[model samples]
Target: MIRPSGRTDSRLLWPIAIHPFTGTVEVVFQHLKRSPPLDDEPLRRELMTKLNEIEGVDLAEAKLDLRPSFPVEVFAEHSEEICAVPEWFAHTVALAEARRMPDGDPGTY
Candidate 1:
């Protein structure tokens, strides 16, 4: 789910990944737009609270990942750099991708 942060105009993208074996969930928050520095903590707290409200869910045990949107300069610097993917981003992508594949093995993928 993607929503605008009420505290600011910035948008937040929440991607959820579920572990088939353990039934564990992973939530990632990616900032889609830049906002004032002062709003960071409050915004994060708000997001966390909202996430906790999900039913049949364990927010505490869920793996949480937060990251900023890629800077425009990265694209100008290099073609591949256009995507400023963090190290953890790959893990999240892999998990998401695996979830979509036929007979996807969540435990090993």
Candidate 2:
């Protein structure tokens, strides 16, 4: 949910997801429509190296996934391709809010 801002603030963004329990890190390549320099392996490796320097991050276990700019509603009726979740939009938003909510309950906090 982080956005980069700068003079060169291209619409491109890299969404990094870190799982607290399993320690799985995912980098979703959502802005493929825009030219992102990380598509280059060298740059990706360099960034991964820097990220791995942190105590808990392991670049080796990192997973790469794509989050297309297309609306989730469009994929709701899709039957051929298997979605990551049974319900994509609700599940995705719930997952995000769950991560944001410390006690797992947004209302309580």
The sequence of per-residue lDDT tens digits that candidate 2 reaches over residues 8-104 is: 1222244344455653445454332233344444544554454444444444533322431222332334433323322332343445446655676
Checking candidate 1 for backbone clashes, the offending pairs are none
The C-alpha TM-scores of every prediction are: 0.29, 0.35
RMSD to native for every prediction? Answer: 17.8, 15.0
Deviation of model 1 at 86, angstroms: 20
lDDT digits (tens) for residues 9-87 of candidate 1: 1122233344456534444443322333212455444445544443333344232335322223323445342222322
lDDT for predicted candidate 2 compared with the true structure:
0.39
Please give the lDDT score for candidate 1.
0.37
Highest-lDDT candidate = 2
Indicate the residue-level lDDT of 99 in model 1. 50
What's the CA error at residue 70 for candidate 2, in Å?
27
